[model samples]
Target: MFLKRIVLSLFCFHVVLGKTPEIREDVRKFPDGFLFGVASASYQVEGAWDEDGKSESIWDHDTHKIPSPIDDMSTGDIADDSYHLYKRDVEMVREMGVDFYRISLSWTRIMPTSFPDKINQAGVDYYNNLINELLKHNIKPMITLFHWDMPQKLQEMGGWTNPNIVDWYGDYVRTAYELFGDRVKYWITINEPTQICLYGYGLNLLAPRLNIPGVADYLCSKNLLLAHARAYHIYDEEFRASQGGNISITLSAQWYEPESELYATASREYLQFDSGVYAHPIFSKEGDWPSIVKEKVARKSAEQGFARSRLPDFTPEEIEYVRGTSDFFGLNHYSSYFVNMDEDTINSYAVPSRADDIGVNVFKLNEWVLSEFSSTDYVPWGFYKLLNYFREEYDNPPIFITENGFGTYYTGLDDDERVTYYRGYIGAVLDAIDDGTNIIGYTAWCLMDNFEWTKGYTVRYGIYHVDFESPNRTRTPRKSAFVYKEIVRTRSLDIGFEPDTSVMTIDEGH
Candidate 1:
């Protein structure tokens, strides 16, 4: 009888295992016109924080003034030193064989005074060199106007929460359009509003740390949406006709699933708070806050004795203005979480945080091997599910995966785990396209390791690992870099194909 029971258990295990999807190379190749690229932000990669007439950004101020927030207490003051090494950086991109490169403009560098009255020639010359280098190599340039590095001068008056930033950001976008729009065809207006609002203002995890939770984050959200719409309109009306470019605001979303069938509503609530609140405003058929977000936040605020909802309202005109502003659904997805409705979860403090507002306890899967900065479980299916959700809810808008990659603290040359992660994620993207999602492009999170904000230099997310301790911040191509290069070159994934070791080289600024 015991033997029979063991046999039954083995049968069930085999059945369950067989049902799980595996990352195999047998799938159809990615569709034609699917772009492959790599992404990096200005403050994260570009050093020279105070060089060539560059003013201090919020990141510069935060890392210098309050280094405690960063894990290693390191600043981007000399990060990668891309300011001086941009030619080498572009050479690395050219070697990778990517179709394009996504980079952000440093707001403070362009307009040190945070006004258009004085345009810095040095900053203009620097971008021109970088853009020209990419163009010379046949690599298209996709520029992001802002990536959480606001000029400190602007933040002093009040950053995104001030409402006046809509115009301030508009002026900045117009300046960028005027300067580089002819050379750059793809424009990402802003990168991850949720991170800027919730993490920076509400949680105080990033630059210009406000930590105001319920009030500041919501205010920032409203203003950010307005600012994005204003920029999109500026480009569409003024620049698009001449330059023929596309504009979008990237939103970083983590796929959320219910901890169990019982917590389905909790998962949905978590999703609404994380990405829906931001996406619904610009992407939904009817612009404005997601109904669930409005209702839940209002209920929570009422419970906390607030006279009105913590989330600021959008006027009818404002909603219409913001609606359909995005040309493509620019997404920056990293990982996934399992959420459960739990009241006893810690709220950081007694005050209502974004997590507290949602009242959901989020957890990583126990099966996922936790690295210094990654989840080894690497659920690519979550990405597939996310794309399907967008298709069903947001009317199948054109999507560009603006940023996606794995990170680790280890600087090992053989990053087999990263290769596997990319294989699975990119495969899932292909699956989504076959399943009718309008995904246009995919850009790996970073071209090389640089300053990782609050985590400082602890976490590395680049295919080409940067030796931060080196005088030149040497670039070493890991095995994943070779794998990525092959994938980009072939325009197809072949799991059995081994990368050529010859492609892995140590860049000593040669």
Candidate 2:
């Protein structure tokens, strides 16, 4: 009987271990006065969609319709009810002692017709109120001009691909500068241009769904970068003098690794093609398209039968104008990976080069990690390594941690894993700062759970958990809320700050 029990135990262990490598956490250090805050995009958190003369955004239709490609088909129609409960939201910010609040402006809400010919006063007022509230509490606002919510009308007019979009985007950006530039000092010309190009045109996954991956996504990527370049030029030449504001675009990233031992030499070579092409023109020491990206895209275009490379060319003048356009860097990072860029990526996966565009095989560290990021190990040290990469590769520019947070599969107020996540992450930022990375500040990925793009609302990255069941979309402080608030109040990571279960219920109400 004892022998039988031992055999059964061994069988159960093998079954349970079908596939989960023993993951290890690498502890790291962090820097001081490295600002820590939280973030929320307009479309995800602010739910007064179509209210107060606000028209529809590209995402509204995607989340509301049948056969909705969204994982949960859950819309942000009443997300956190932040539009109404902003006061409560601010209180949370205050309690958390956040030094800055990163907020995005919905294009449809600010300019209902998707043009400057008309400004929705109600829409303007709603944003004005939110901004003023942040300033009132001494929280500086980091405003993102666009965050995936394009005006539905823009979709009808051919969004980013149409070359004419250069002028259209310029007009909208100029108007935004004129209207909100004074109050909003930090402006992101665009958010995740890679995703916009890849998902919108290539995958037919995001709104205004189009499935011309090799074709449309690549074309869109070029036009989209030009649009960003033009927008940056407008701000630098026109607005910087008067508006006295700073501008940059945000990129979503995962660390890369080459397939074999020799792959490390060309690791960044792969990154230069994927993200570097998009970023080098704007942020590199000598801003222009990386030679590798230009050569590959051009070669691929010819092979695929195009008049010219799918990538739009920038004149010498255009290159100079775009270089050094940014006053700072905005990075939205989640995880890191080992990248393989050979037939493993192309022939085997058939993933549009838009994804593994590097023309090399990209293999991951593990499979249990989840999402597109499963390729990456959750090494906080990767954050340190990435920061070092930015400093050494691109000229060391001031960077803002536009978004970073740990995601989980459950909902509970007593979230200790989140505490450890912040402990490690925030510490890593400090480590980078100590190493002279010039990281200005860090913002938590979310203030409250809202609509996560492709994954839908299933993922929660909030410090303060939102109750979807509550009619008011009530937000009660999660255990992490108290953990974060105390860190804020003390202005220090409480090495001495051991979280007790009691803090979860004890409200030193703000």
Candidate 3:
């Protein structure tokens, strides 16, 4: 035990020192059944958008519309061409020797018109093929029902802000459960409700972009939570016993540290807005929204001279329905920020959005080293701290890290930064697990680079680099892919081992 602490201390020091240090792989290995997997979203990876009778997703409509919002003005119309090339994807997963593969279902693909009557047989067959392929390769499937690819029909009816979306989502998810629930054992109802509510609605960033700012986001939040809860109960009531599956919602959280002790409250408020608002209603024992979120949004709405509140309130029965819905906290964490009080900006009303509700200015930590890829800082310790925050604040629920990885704008095979980042973060996960955080799994953000939403293909977060320029969308395994494959294969963080991506070989487990 003393030696373990010494090894852990050395690993932390190596992270802080920004230098390679000698370490024992077996000592640093994750616990048994600690799922080392990779994730991919439907719209991002699956092309053949119009093929197989699939209708237009909001992403399909948004990226094609005039004044495109994507960074490269690129669309996921062709994406990684995984729709036609899924066999290759399965081969890659098999090569990785991972325990599971996290994949999302496209709502438009399943029910193109967003109605119960029109079940796209081709779309259903495609997913069946994909799931069966994964299962054939001995890779467990972790399926996400919605990864922000709302059917354009649903978006036309006011998207998430429409109260009817609760039923709409319920019907769509129920259809999914009935069709695919037999094989899929791990289910994610929604992926990052905060992103859907805040980025897509509050800010005009994502698809079905509505720049309604403060008002649209709150309405969407309430509806989104209800949608997730309703789906969970549907699974619990109709599918759980027979399907034997676990259901949860994925929430993206970037750890925030106070810029100074003075801004500690601001940091806490950042948490309230970013994660607490979405998670509190479902995960917290007391249900309802976070007290800080409800109080602040109400106060801000009143200040803006709104009747009632911009943030909607949940009825008592609704709160009860939403609580205790998750079997695990599906977390998608990537980076960290240092937050400080910015009252002057908060008072100015130059821009009235979700940012104003928290009344804080956020920046990256001082010590973080930036890469050429994205503005994300490499602070693995932040992950450890974030896990502890959940452990203490949210009653230590079982956790599955659905997405955590490094992103770079460059598409290079030699991603030493990503390798180091993974090592440090995986080490941090082990540290958090040792400290009593109920974390069960850790999935790398991606299996290969795909169309990264608004950023399009500007940033690459995958261990395998996809040649978007190539007609075939050839996926070449990067050094990081080899490293990850080794980790998953060995179930240990073998820091000293160097992987050779030049050759292909499955682990002994395969």
Candidate 4:
């Protein structure tokens, strides 16, 4: 035991001194029964925005009405034409040799009226065909019910901020379960509620740019959580026994590292605000908002002259309904931030803003390596810490890394940086597994390049490159795709493995 402690101390010292840890071949091997898959969202990939009785989503409305809302002045009106090319997408998924494919169902596409009053048969046919194609190739399907593409009709009706959205969303989710739950074993109720509530509602950075900060964003959080719980309960009570499927919500969980030990509490508070707001109600033993979040937001609201806290409170019944709603923890992680406690940070943010309410400043370290085309920095240690944090804080719930990938500019077929990013982050996963994290599966962020929300096509997170300018929107596998394929095929991470990028083809029996 003394010798083991000495070796562990040396390993920690090397890690702190920026020395690379020795990679053992055994460390690279994934546990048997661990799953690998790739992911894509509806608005990001599917075109045919207005075709086949499909109504407009908030993304369609925002991109059409707001000038230069996207970085490339581009709209997802015809992203990748996946509506027409889903078979090719299934082919790509097969080529990657994954266990499943994660895709989202567009709310407006299935229910053009944004309600169960009418179901669009044509939209149902589209997904039916995709799911059938995937199953034909022996690939399981994991479907996300919502991925930040609320129907324009719903937005006009106050969207997620209105308490009535719970029933509306419950009706939509019930219709979806009745339609596709039989084929889909994994169902994600909503993807990245933090991104939906904070970016879209608070910062005006995403669709339906409400920009009401601490007010509208908080309302969206409560209503969205209730809606998610509604969907989970509807499935649990109505569909689970018949379908034998699992349902959960996805949260964007970037690590919040403190700049110094002094600001550790600040960093924890930031994470509580960022992810805990959405995750706590579902995963926490208490089944309510984090105590720190409630206290801080309420105290700030009082000082801001508000009669009540900006953060909404959950009723006792609502709390009970939300607790244990998720079958698994769906996480989408990318990068990390160093947070510091600074009183002056409040002045930089808009008054009563989420940032000001949290009362911390976050920034990336200059020494960290950034992705080629985006602000994401390489910090696999953060990923390792985050998984362990989830295990410790949330009672080690089964975790599926529903989205993890690096974005880059169109740098042709050789994407070495992305390859490195995957290797490092996935290595972190293996480390977490060794330390007893109940991680079940891993998923790449996307299958191919498509419309990347505000970034548009400027940032590509796909293993396969899509030529957005081409009439066919042709997709060609990048070097990272081959590397990822090898990892999937072998169920091990070969840090020194190099693929022959001359030609890409599906492996035998894939």
Candidate 5:
């Protein structure tokens, strides 16, 4: 145990030290039956938008129209060229010993105008070929229905804020069921509604960048959840009879803590708004918005001179539609921190008056309550707490560690820090599983590094590194890939298997 700690420290230090860990690989200790997988999204990797009878999505317009918004001014123009090289992608997934491949369907790709007045055969062929290819290799295809890239037309139609979107989304879900539901057994309704509503509508950081007054984000939040529930309802009542698949939502969360013992009172309210408002309605036993959120939104709406509460009201029918819409919870976790609870103290920030739910003044383990923009606190144990919280709260609904990985500040094939990040984070997941959390699978954040939203390609999150300088978008496996590959292959971390520090291997691709 002491040796592992030293190795972990040395791994982090190696990023700057330019030296390597001397540990042996056989010493790894991951357990058996731990499933492994890699993930990618439609907009991030598929580049032939205009070629396949597919219409543009909001991301296409956002990334291309304002290239300057991205740090490297890089767009997903050719991004890994996965739309064409997906067979190679399947090869990589098979080689990695990963049991599942998680990918999202592009709304614009299938239903050109975001509506199914016409089903694009070419668009259907794209996913159809990809899905069958995965099955050929005995790899399970895990499909995410929507991953933030809403149809461009939908954006003009008020996107998620417009209540009509609930029906529009249901149509899309039903179409997907008709097309690929036969082979694909797992489905995710939405990636992260909080990110879409809070960042896109509140911070103006994502698609359909509309920082509308009270009506933008809150309405978007309500409609997004309703859309998810509506889609699930259609699948359950209309499609499940023949399809027989699992549907769930992938939620993003940052574990919150109070900055100080004295500040605990204040931080809880912040979390209740940011995390609770978004999650409680779906996960709570009674399936209604938390009392704090209902009261707060009502008071804020009244102060803003609105006749009705800005937050959309759920009809009894809508609540039931939104309630229990998940077969499992898809959790995308990365980091956490304690937060400053004092509202007045937090109000001093130059944050937009519209954004409170963002949980400003977060106290990372580094002892700084920085904003989420800069908080990369490393707390693996937080995931254990998270899994336990859900296990107890939601009556042990199954969980998939949908997305968990560390963001990097440096680059190299020898990603010791990433290995450490995976080791600790996944170790925490294993711990939760031991304590009886119904976590059945784990999928890392991404397969190859690709366009990262506003941050662009500057942040690297892939186990397999992609060279942006190369026109070919060449992918090279980082040392961490070997670490992860072994975990996938053996379904155990051979704390015993050391980094292949032997200078070089004569046998290539063995």
Candidate 6:
């Protein structure tokens, strides 16, 4: 099934060019106080899987135990060696002139036993050094507590599927706040719960590969939402008064465009299934599962002889607890898909799966422009629509774009495609802002190339290139890096500006 998805993803190359929106000069300038930054996750970049008292994370276990899942049979055992060369990472971001640098804390690294009973001082010191280094360079730190690298011991204890994780996660987050809340001003409780729950638990595409579709995925989602609320409440009650920081959860959202007017409802429901499952609980006024999602899953579960709906329901108290937990909507958007519904599409999934429950087929239109090296389609207008949807649905919450980037096969430094991708997407962001969306920040997906999960090193999404073969894992600035630097430095997206590719250097104060 995983291999089948991979083959389907590769079909994105068959897409034709769509109409690219013209960037008006007036819409190119970003709002004042709007932040610019780059983001990286610990498991993807931090390679000290077991170094300095750090225990194994689920990624460590998965890649080692079943290397076949990774395209290159590679592991993140030494990805970018950021555990040792974090100073160089700081330098790269400084050179880019970003206002902040977002990174995730490794659960296993800080609490090697998967609990707060024994704090790893060496792990704590390593993060302290990174945080201190960023602050010295005037870069604010935006830290995510969990970015899918749960401790293996905790996974052995049933991971997110186990309701006990609500307390387990709450304790872990409290320890993080107590240790680093003094310096870090922006905290993301968890990054992309849908990716963590659905992909990792349902699809078997990622680590921990639970793959118990419909049942396990729904259980994971329920517990994850509670865990997120627990973390938010912990920060609110304990750290917010003293630390003065903002916290939220990031969602991996992709705009789902209906294939036609006939399929509008299908697209809306697909969006609900894709991201609304998580978003509705936290951001909606009612704060339970979406009615359509509940109805659909319940009907299907009854047909399958299950005693209850496959999607776990939030109790009244749980609903209120999760409701309004986020300070801002942390979003990670990459592309868009056209959603369709028909008997054939519904029958294509395993009988008791998420796809079966959603009852929709989502695919990129052949008319959309395709990224040459990745499955992501270029559809900036879709981004514009998604922002509008969020503004209208969630009553105009402040939005922080936590991760957005173009991925590619490791082509050298002259990455024109990525530059174009950024320019188009940022233009869409400006359009959304002009339409009264409360977008406060934008973060490029990463600072440099590192371990890219299941695709392994086969795909790259970094502004700077890392030579994985080199002992230094040498970093070199790509063309997109210079383009991004200009945008950050000037606080404007000059669509026509072409940066000089001759030299890459840190600007004088950076």
- What shift in Å separates residue 345 of candidate 3 from its native position after superposition? 3.7
lDDT (10s digit) by residue, model 2, range 1-510: 557545533432332222322222442223456677788898888888878888888899778778878888788777777788888877778767777888888888878888888988887887789889888878878888889887788877778778788788888888888877887888888888777887787777887687776667766766777788788889888888887878888887656644444455346566676677677888876777887677777787787677887667778887886777677788878776665445534565443455544566665555424444222235566666677567656768888879888777556676666776676666666666666789987788778877777677777778777888887777766777777766665655654466654644323433
Model 1 C-alpha lDDT per residue in residues 1-510, reported as the tens digit of each score:
557545533432332222324567673577788898998989998899999999999999899874277889898999999989998888888878888999999999999999898999999999999999889888899999999999999899989989999999999999999999998999999999989998888877888889898889999999999999999999999999999999999999887776565666666667778898889989988889977688878998899899999998999999999999989999998887777766667454346667777778888766565454463358787787787667766889999999999888777778888888888888888877877999999999789988888888888888888988898889888888888887877788887778776655432322
Give the distance in Å from residue 292's predicted Cα in candidate 3 to where it truly belongs: 1.3
- Where model 5 places Cα greater than 4 Å from the true spot, the runs are 1-34, 342-345, 349-354, 357-360, 365-376, 494-496, 501-510
Q: Which stretches of candidate 2 lie over 4 Å from their true place?
A: 1-33, 341-345, 349-352, 367-377, 494-496, 501-510
Q: Which lDDT tens digits does candidate 3 get at residues 292-375? A: 777887898788788877788899999999999999999999888877666675676434577877777887754676554544
Residue-by-residue lDDT tens digits, candidate 4, 1-510 = 557545533433332233333445553799999999999999999989999999999999988874678888898999999999998999999999999999999999999999999999999999999999999888999999999999998899899999999999999999999999899999999999988988889879998899999999999999999999999989999999999999999999988877765666666678788888888889988899987789889999999999999998999999998888999999999998888766676578997888988888998876676544544578888888888778867889999999999887754788888888899999999988988999999999879998999988888889999998897889989999999999999999998898987777775465
TM-score of each: 0.93, 0.87, 0.93, 0.94, 0.87, 0.95
- TM for candidate 4 is 0.94
Local distance difference test, candidate 1: 0.84
Residue 489 displacement (Å), model 6: 0.8
Which residues of candidate 6, in runs, are more than 4 Å off?
1-21, 25-27, 367-372
For candidate 6, give the lDDT. 0.88
Alpha-carbon local distance difference test for all models: 0.84, 0.72, 0.85, 0.88, 0.74, 0.88
RMSD of each: 7.0, 9.8, 5.7, 4.6, 8.0, 5.9
Model 6 C-alpha lDDT per residue in residues 1-510, reported as the tens digit of each score: 557434423322111122334666652678899999999999999897889999998899988974378999888999999999999999998999899999999989999998999999999999999999999999999999999999998898999999999999999999999999999999999898888888899879888898899998999999999999999999999999999999999999998777765666676778789889999999999899977789999999999999988888888999999999999999999999887776786798997999999889888776665555654577888898888778877899999999999888846898888888899899999988988999999999879888889989998999999999998999999999999999999999888788998987887676
**Residue 365 C-alpha lDDT in model 5:** 62
Candidate 2 TM-score to native: 0.87
TM-score-superior candidate, 3 or 6: 6
Candidate 1: stretches off by over 4 Å:
1-20, 346-349, 370-377, 504-510
The clash numbers for all candidates, in the given order, read 0, 16, 2, 0, 21, 0
Worst 10 residues of 2 by lDDT: 15-24
Q: Is candidate 2 or candidate 3 better by lDDT?
A: 3
RMSD (Cα, Å) of model 5: 8.0
Better of 1 and 2 by lDDT: 1
